[model samples]
Target: LENTEFNLLSMMYDVANILAFKAEEKGLELSCFIDPYIDPFVIGDPLRIRQVLINLTNNSLKFTEKGEVSIRGTLKEDLGNRFSLWFSVRDTGIGIPEEKLDKIFESFSQADTSTTRRFGGTGLRLSISRTLVEMMGGSLSVSSVEGKWSEFKFFIYLEKQASDSVSRKDIDIDLSTKNILIVDDNKTNRDILRQQLLKWKCKVVEAESGKAALAKMREAVDSMSPFNLAIVDLQMPAMDGLDFGRLVKSDDDLKSTILVLLSSVTNKGEIDTSKNIGSSRYLSKPLKQSDLYNCLMAMFYRESKSEKILETVSEPTGIIDGVKILLTEDNLINQKVAVKILEKSHHKVACANNGEEAVKMLEADHYDLVLMDCQMPVMDGYEATKLIRSKPEISAIPIIALTASALKGDREKCIEAGMDDYLTKPLKREELNMMLSKWANKKHKQ
Candidate 1:
């Protein structure tokens, strides 16, 4: 058993982000809620826990056609160093019939024969999930309403590392009097944000659209009780986040309020535009409470310290031009496409057909970063990264994995192999540039 100390919230966030694309593709909202009472740090097999979570969540997404899927963790019992945590994966999906529920966890078995034919799964996910949960000292159970919804719940015990627990009162920033505004087109999204903000003791106002948000901001300012911050959604109907932020920042009255723009995609252009228009921060959607808290803390605590807040809360502004990049790929077409994109950004680009060639090139020359492809002939990116990391002369140069695989755990696999970052294939220019810019300032070995 790999019992190690890790942050439960961070692990859940990783699972949520890894599956975010699949959730988006299905047009289903994927959200996670971790009860604040749950100990943040616990001793257990994080990998195993993460595996069970991914499997269960994947199963829920597979069966769900519309609506939402939510993963939640709540504290069942807390005894200082030992705690019982309850985890549930709930979905508004096709539910298991009461009669067939018993067979759902069987090996190679689904709810029914028609499910097997239509879903095209080996039906092993639940079997594995249940086994994993039981192995971790938990009994997995399910509840369903046949045609309505399904929830899989389990309770597991974990040993919390003996440390001083930090509560909201212990935090450095006091949010008790802060008035925040949340703008999102979806009620569920708004509710999620509202709950989190309320938990932090901040007063919150919700707006269903950018226009409504603008009205609220103006009204509050005129009433002499302006919102301290406005969390705006990027993709809204009439007036999106950028337009709303432009109006807010342009006005002398509302300019002092912090603006945070949330987007589902990592579009570099949008990030740059948000920053240029005086937005204080940009965060990803299906927002994590921890991230939002950190952003707010940075914004409020270092209100006058623009440089410090930027380093803490903001994305790298724009493309870092003129850095030399090593592109490693066995596919000729991918190499050509990447080189063209890099050259367009005014970056010096070099190509390697495979990992071995890439290593040889790196040894012979200096590059700011290595864009390593995960799979190739002779050697793969993982082995190449290991080899590069072993050599002190080249170890400090950043290695970013470029792969077409969006499979579960692919990102963790890349990081475990010593890659600094990951980028899925069919690359977007904006995302590529943003990733490069993020690592461009890394202290490279001379």
Candidate 2:
């Protein structure tokens, strides 16, 4: 879960651009364009906003075949203090019938049987998008021509920034002045890094392959504008990122350049393998802002940023075992109640409002165990746990899920997501204590 405030256009466009590679696989062109006049800075739940954009763009990609799928943003109203932002995803694939436009937005509905058979979706995207938009005080709308094209749009508002107050990452240095080169064969991964770095005002250049990246490096040296940093994906063809990193480090001409490795953790054990490569730092894939931010800080200065658990053993009984644990849940009432209960038992406890916060806390501090909520926003417990499992360093720390219900198959899903156990809601004091006792004493393996 990431909490950094970002420019509105950059945030939305990042989500839109990440799917470009997926569209490319289907032989379609995908792009995102933002209006220049928009204030661009806004503070909101970026993850939720991204979810809405990705869903819309993905839907457009599914039906698009011959032409392009594009995301466009423009200013709708200049309110002085704030502005209304409008975004649309237009596709030149199979268009929806005029009469069926409204029908498709209905719950569990698609355009028609033929549409479902060909495109393959539950038709729940618009329905879900409408709900999410309304929650953010926005409205979702659509327009299309039968068998020609489709355009889905939405409007949201953001307060204008009087000045630059987004984030400085607590460093006085201006990262905006730095030049960076991004290397990754996967278009989506490269775009993700570009969006993040560019938002910080850094100059960015892209290299689709490792060899191209090396060429760009040598060219920059010749031009007397060598990159300050190069973030390369750990997995690439013709030259693996490890070998590429070695080559860059060995080159006397590129002596001062910083190299950070990006790993996908496709092979769980490779997380350790990545560390063996010489570089400033290495991070797991689907790159995280906090991790990337700290990695940059380390290159300038080092420090920071976790996952699942195994079945833990119970400790000897006492008046209070004095076990320390981190509890991540979004419900304030539950937070208070859980803290009250744990404190009385002489257990040290801390809380995170959401999964994203939970991950950040785990990275910066130590906790004997984690009580994770399954459905919280930013990053769900399921995803958080999977990420933890990918990191060999923290994967063995036990995690128990806090789920609202124990519906059929819910346990399996939690376990698959890497949780060692789960606690049902309306949680009983006895159940909470028992689960903690099972996991609380065994510490994280160093």
Candidate 3:
């Protein structure tokens, strides 16, 4: 068995070799360039770093067919006390478009159906890689072209010391002394939030409505133990995120407490209003653990841990409130089927009969998620998604491939086009509902 503590270059080379073999199968050249002066002994979990490198290299090999795939590592000395190392995997395959570049690190994202069909993979490598990098005090990034090539780059800080000298004991991160109030009408949403907060060893309180939240605030003050932070949901029954934030900010006693607005709407105006109401931050629902942890760290650590903390949380806005969705498909029947599935959940849905329409719609409106079809009249889902992601305004919208094509690489292609998620053709209600529910609920919690 491999040791978990050491950062082994040999293992990294082995992974590169495996990917190189895969690349050669498609007549692609693969190579690696490692800086000789770089420190070989760095503090980190070797297994996790290896996992990140393997995933990135594998992705490069999977996408490149006719050209070379290169992996390189270089150390930067200008990082002050921190030793910053940059690692990149370059591929001469079809590069990613500029707009879709941001979503590449998001989970389940793929470029398009064509890429997915040609290469079979879940498109989760980058997201997983990003998570691993962050845990090791680093960041992962990418640069790409539409048809030329793509490059995945990451930077990590390595403490110049032996692993044994560093304390490996788990740190007790407690939020129990500080009160946390959760405002969400949905019981399921409240439960999930509570569970996650509890994992952080927080003392959690729940509010089912805006009125209840206010009452709880009053009760907490009266009881001589007030909340340190309030997590409020938008688009609720009585008071929405904006109104609730306004109320909390206006109150002298509660104004100082951090307010986090959670929503499923990508309405920019609403987000601005929340900012004006003294909300420290906004979180989109379908809340990821990393995002939540980062927000909390920012709040508590404030000045000292700002950069490290905020990196984990997204901008906290641009979430879809009424279930902002993009529907892509050429067949009218399939579009209707998809719409019916979403509408049943009372989610607002948008439709594109062809890839061109999908692109146009994406340009016109901000969607929380997109459902794309493989085949279409004017433009196909692959081309449309690729184009949509190439645009800055709509690039981050989660694009789910809705196609009849079930080939091996089709999923990978969808991810390669910067699509966030995927669903097979002859859509099933249960599957769609599960996805919508999971993501929508996450938005609600944020």
The 0-to-1 C-alpha lDDT of every candidate, in the order given, reads 0.78, 0.69, 0.67
**Model 3 lDDT tens row, 1-446:** 11233333333454454354345446554555445345444444544555567668767777777756777677866454347888888888888878878877877777676767877654555776787677677888898888998888888766544534331222236777778999987665576578668767898999999999999998898898899999888768768878888888889877777898876423435777888888887875444444576688788875664444333122222333478777777778887878887777677887777888777777777666677777777888777865654443454455677767787666556655555457887999888876666444333322
Q: Which run of 10 residues does model 1 get worst, by summed lDDT?
A: 165-174
lDDT of 1 by residue, 1-446 (tens): 45666667766876687677667767778888887545566778765677677768877888899988998888888876788899999999988899988877887777777876886553555776787778779889999998789999988889886665321122223488899999988777787788778777898999999888888989999999999999988878899889988998898988888899988743435888999999989998667766787788778875554334223223335566688999999999888889999999899999998889988999999887899999999999998986775454565467899989999768766754657679999888988988887666432200
Colliding pairs, model 2: 1-356, 298-302, 307-388, 309-397, 309-398
Best by lDDT: 1
Which of candidates 2 and 3 is the stronger one according to TM-score? 2
Best by TM-score: 1
lDDT of 2 by residue, 354-397 (tens): 87787778777767678998988888898887666544344445
Candidate number that wins on lDDT, 1 or 3: 1
Q: TM-scores for all candidates?
A: 0.66, 0.51, 0.37
Clashes of 3: 42
- What stretches of model 2 exceed 4 Å from their correct place? 1-78, 86-102, 112-125, 131-137, 142-152, 160-173, 186-192, 195-201, 265-268, 288-290, 302-446
Better of 1 and 3 by TM-score: 1
